[model samples]
Target chain A: MNEAGTTVIEARNLDLTFQTNDGPIHALKDVNLAINKGDFVSFIGPSGCGKTTFLRCIAALETPTGGALTVNGMTPDEARRSRAYGYVFQAAGLYPWRTIAKNIKLPLEIMGYSSAEQDERVNKVLELVDLAGFGGKFPWQLSGGMQQRASIARALAFDADILLMDEPFGALDEIVRDHLNEQLLALWARTEKTIGFVTHSIPEAVYLSTKIVVMSPRPGRITDVIDSPLPKERPLDIRDTPEFIEVAHRVREGLRAGHGDDV
Target chain B: MKQIIAVLTVIAALVVVWYAACIPMNIKGVLTEQERAGAEVQPPSAKDRRDLSEIGLALNNSFAIPATWEQDRPRLPAPHQVAIELWETTVQKKITSKRSLIYHGWVTLSATMLGFAIGTGLGILLAVGIVHSRVMDLSVMPWAIVSQTIPIIALAPMIIVVLYSVGIQGIIPKAIISAYLSFFPVVVGMVKGLRSPDAMQLDLLRTYNASRSQGFWKLRLPASMPYLFTSLKIGVAASLVGAIVGELPTGAVAGLGARLLAGSYYGQTVQIWSALFAAAILAACLVGLLGLIERAVLKRMGMAQ
Candidate 1:
């Protein structure tokens, strides 16, 4: 589980309630989690489970209304300002006006990286996403899967120590999603960066993570945290293993328990 | 090619309709002149020859219809007369001649171009303000609405008189009026464009910890291009209208509005129609230029098809 290092992200009794026009909607409540360095943790829950909200908190894109949340031993906002992590949103979110290379260069430009450095970083990240020769194409000119990879390249360009991915492969079909998952696992293995991935897919969660966090909605709270015993070097056939099946069954049970709590 | 053919067909139809309509409108002048000519022809009972039946007959009888088409001071001039007048003033006369439409058209074009620049600058500034600050959005938008509601015709003379009183004359007041007309569309379009980025795009910039100015430069401004050019086209046309209206009250000696006034005073229907056509042509060219610019810029940015 990569427990040899200090914690990268720590949450304690975190609460977030959005005051919408209808009323106060509880998004997260009494959530406690600790993610150590170089660990791949997946947050798996159904819709409205605040799994996305929790990822947003880590990126400081959303503020927690109560309790404490920390990234890299500092406030999430500070960590964000210091460029601690790269975030991949659900949609590619590439600026339509920019080519793939330029889109990846956005963060570098924002950070005032030199033109040469920006170019170097963009090339390296494009290679990382396996989109090496497609840098000159516009986002719309590329296939949807290619566009998503370009967005991942954009996030990875600045060489941050952590990557916060919000269901990046959720929109893809099974085949492309499987391909991306394998590539992501390979990328993670090479980088050894802390990753907090949010997803709704049980198989995806089981396949990708060293640790899995199952969350419940209607006042989102952590229902269970499973430390998978599956080997780190998992192939596509790992899902057939009895141990993998057992963990997947436990995750399915945790999800059912979450639905039962609300109904 | 199809578009050009379609446009030409529409224009040909319009000319045919115009020529037919002129026979009815100018029939009275022709009938009276025919009576003066002492031709022993029985005049159809056409409410003194300016009625529908007489016009229909005139359309059929080529011999009699020529007189109506050639009336000295007809209610409606024939399409050919207007065309002839336009050719003579624009092509036959020297450019600097008092009789030349070119001189007047140049004046109006100058004012339109000047006003468009001012309005574009003011619009972009106001749009930036509105997008960045809530107070500006609330305050400026209502005032912009009020400004438009106050009729340009009512506002033009007041602007002229005030500018004259302040020792400002000629093109500045006209440009100001044009600027006023053009500014609103720019403001509205630019605001929409600047805010065009979706929630996810904005959140992405925030994740990068980009400042507001960075957000504006990197995302908002570039996104607003298509909208800006569209508004600019509308604004430029409105500016031309403003410049012409500004010429109206002063009874200016130069400009297309002056030509319209002069033609009206002397019962020169053909001249007025010609001047109106010239103005319309000028407007088309301006908008066409904007379209060309839009294509080049959007294509460069990879935003064009």
Candidate 2:
């Protein structure tokens, strides 16, 4: 792993304006932030707050209209071409025609990995996501939570150093979401990869992140970026602790403050 | 079981309606035959019979009911006449014999299958090109739509003539016509299907920096399967029609179309009806085969739901 303090993603006055028939809408505006190596960073905000857009930009799925955004000191597009990160969308988005293992092998196939190595990596990631035995099943055969886990495994199979997720658990029930959240934290701990997560949940944001960036809509921009002082090794019960509650409160304040500007 | 029973009920209703309609149509011929046989008949002269309604004649001559259904050169063959002809031509006659419906059916089917294969192959290739290239989509799609607007019946004769002039004879010309009729549905369906993957699915591949070919092979092609099968069912039926139509203008000596034409020339209504039934049955079999293949494939792909 790179040095702990080494910046993996840096956005400097990032601006994205989308021109539509109605008018120009700012998706991200004057956004400035830094995500260090191995940091679990969560971007929390309301709908249209550009939280998802920001993560998409990091993955190079969307291009910023103006300003500089870099991943691992390279342009997002360049970083993407280098396969520096894996992305999980809100939906699992598994191809129905393929088994979970085959879906996980998709990127490896595109990148021209050997057949044997592809299987090995697939098995490893399936195990990582607690879907080891379920690899033979198709996406439709699995429950939504299990399907989402398989998708996460697919993203991890390629072992990119950075993971970008856009509300990956947004569709799940609360119980399943909580369970996946704990599993995700465990996975992140084992992998030690930098993560950029976009979500609307406060406790989830507080529970999972080493740092939280709260954002709002209407010329979407960040209101505050808080570095958590909580210990890295956190359990599910950590949410009950005063420190976790304090950070959660700060995140809520930042979200409100961002929303306050629009109203 | 309920669905099968429902289908059988519908078929039974149609047969009853068909048998009822046969009475009025064949009554005149039945009357003529009976008059020739010197039987006592209302409106004794043929001219008088022409002025009288066939239904009225049938009501007056209730004795002629069985005769109406058994005429050798009847204007409309009864359901039993067509069925007997179908059964005899398909089963009693040797398959290799000229009189055999199976032989004619095979001739038409071979052309349909060949044409379907060519059309589906071309259609999928064109669809892939259209999905990937804006220029192809603009240029090729309009022509495909325009091609289908010209009725196959109107075009079949010209195609036969042109192909005959080129020394291309027999099944190839018919297959070409079949391909022409079938290709459009495939192009339309496949274009929609190949474009079926949503924005998020495409974006996932983009995040992986997957090449265009990768996107196509892994995403677009497999996604198009359900659409492909639907269009194939339609295409295969269209192909049969094309093959049958192609046979009509060419004065072909064999196949179901030839049998229909020959039967018409001789006023052999039974033969024509049998040939028509054979064609219908053949189309059903082709479509049913496609449905089976589609079900198995989609089930294996885990998309059966």
lDDT of each: 0.91, 0.92
Mark the regions of model 1 whose C-alpha exceeds 4 Å error after superposition.
A1-3, A261-263, B1-5, B41-63
As for candidate 1, its clashing pairs are none
Encode model 2's per-residue lDDT on B122-228: one tens digit a residue: 99899989999999999999999899889888999999889889999999999999999899889999999999999999998998899999999999999999999
Reference interface contacts recovered per candidate:
0.77, 0.83
Chain A only: TM-score per candidate: 0.97, 0.98
Best candidate, TM-score-wise? 2
Error at B302, model 1, angstroms = 0.7
The sequence of per-residue lDDT tens digits that candidate 1 reaches over residues A61-156 is 999999999998899999999999999999998988999999999999999999999999988888888999999998889988899999988888
Question: Model 1 over residues B92-169: C-alpha lDDT tens digits?
Answer: 999999889999999999999999999999999999999999999999999998999999999899999999999999
